[model samples]
Target: MRWRCVTGGLLVVMGLAVVHAALEHDEPIIGVDLDGNLFINTSSSADGHTRRLLLNGVDVLRELTELRQKCAGNVPRTTTTAPSTVAASTAMPVSYTGTVGCQLESVPSNVTHLFGNVSLSFCPLLTAESLKVFNELVYVSGDLKIELNTNLTNVDGLGSITSVGDSFFINSNDALINVAGVGNITSVGGDVDIRYNEALVNVDGLGSITSVGGYLSIFSNPVLDNVDGLRSITDVGGYLSIRANAALTNVDGLGSITIVRGYLGIYGNDALTNVDGLGNITSVEGTLHICSNSQLDTSTVPESVRSLGTCQVITSENCMTC
Candidate 1:
């Protein structure tokens, strides 16, 4: 033992041999910029309740080596997925392996496209519970093609739920009808295109929010009566159309708005009486047709726009170029 101590002393003095050694790989420590390329060795006891801390460099390396040697092959070294904690009806924490916060480069080759299957029906809508009502369906991967909206989706047939997240996709739903109770949503990251929803009626609830990213069109919502929520929006990057909303009545919230490139078409809103909101509109890039509104009145329109556009009514004598 005295000879062994002498040999250890000589090794320490030489700096070539030590009782412990650093591991092969260095992992990136994640946080808000505090790591200086260093991490101390840390672990909990067998029960995993109490932790033991080891200091810098060689001593840590040695203790870890001893742990590995003592356990032989029991140390877990790798994980195929990101960390995720799920809550279910059981209301207890259940840990499962799944890729969540991984960036584009971190994704595995097995996953080519993220949201693979575009199913029509949202067959089983995910609900919130006591400890974990998901306030966000966020995607931190930094991909523009994908969206992370928890409060973004609105459903209506059965007193429909309009949970607000980011922005939920239409997902190619065809034979769908009626989105009623979905008025609580107040924010949209992108455009809100309420197209191809044939049986949709009275989309009056989406009024709480005040911004949108892209074009805002209310096309083909055949029975939609009023664009009440859209009244506050003052800017649009693309076209702002109320085209083909046959039953739409008022464009009230668009009071302070002005469009640049796209047309302001109110082609077939058969019941629209006043384009009263267009008084402050200073310019238009395309046609501002209030044609075939059958019930429209030119008295509310400014005289400058009277000659630039035509007006129509159900009565032949009060119709066209009014």
Candidate 2:
């Protein structure tokens, strides 16, 4: 198979005749960049003519291998497509695909928009100062996940980001106090999950997010006292779950949510006394689960939502009606 070199160390394979054979081998042809990031050229059966350059570590390679096996015989061949022209100027915003691990020292300072997913997980050295490089990033074309960062106190460094094209996940950060840094983000094209942050007190930073195309889950954050920051979210395309947040007293911030396309679950939040914030929700397409919240006043649940769509309404376990 003939190979064409593209910018950013990507190599596009021309022939699809040997694509399955190359994937079947124990060691597929892969490129390793100076920063130790892995790159692979893989055929996309969906389009059948163009191949995509994927960037990630070993885990992504393994996932690609499994995908190749599943779609082995179905791939169709066509004339090889020419590579897109790359701009030589460094001042231009770099567009990329696939997943990128956030390495503080290696991050490109010129990037304003990243076309793929970004993950900042288990990064012990990632402090507020080091995150300043990302202050200029205005958008992410895919998911942005910040998880398990032990030393990070706030995400104020992400102040310039206006939107995420896919999911936004903030999970398991031991020292994170708030997500005020992402306050400028106006929308998410997919799910928004904020869970398991031990020291998190509020989600005031998310006040600007107006819509989520998928689920919205804020779960298991023990010290989370209020979601008043979520005042702007108007729609959720999937389930909306706020569960196990022991210190959450009210959902006053969710007052703007008008529709949830899937289930609405508010379970196990011990201190959640008021759900008056959910007063504006006009529709929930699935089940309504408000269970195990001992101090919740069942009467506060608006009569407009008592029926909760076509599905069952589960209100149980010491929830008193005022």
Relative to the true structure, how large is the alpha-carbon lDDT of every model?
Answer: 0.45, 0.80
Q: How does model 2 fare in lDDT?
A: 0.80
lDDT of 1 at 119: 18
TM-score of each: 0.44, 0.68
lDDT of 2 at 204: 91
lDDT of 1 by residue, 1-322 (tens): 0111121122122234332322333432222436555453443344555443323333443555564454555444677896567645543322222333312233332322232221123333222221022122212111111122122233432122222223323322233343333344444555556665655565555554455545567776676677765665666645567766777777765675655245566666777777776666666655556565667765666655544322322221222432
Residue 36 lDDT (model 1): 52
**Which parts of model 1 have CA positions greater than 4 angstroms off?**
1-135, 138-190, 304-322
Q: Candidate 2 residues 1-322, lDDT tens each?
A: 3333333343434334422322323555566889999666454434454433333212334444555555554455578888869757556666545567856555677568877888988888887776788878899999999998888898888999999999999999999999999999999999999999999999999999999999999999999999988899999999999999999998899899999999888889999887888788899998887778888877778777777766644465833332
Q: What is the TM-score of candidate 2?
A: 0.68
Best by lDDT: 2
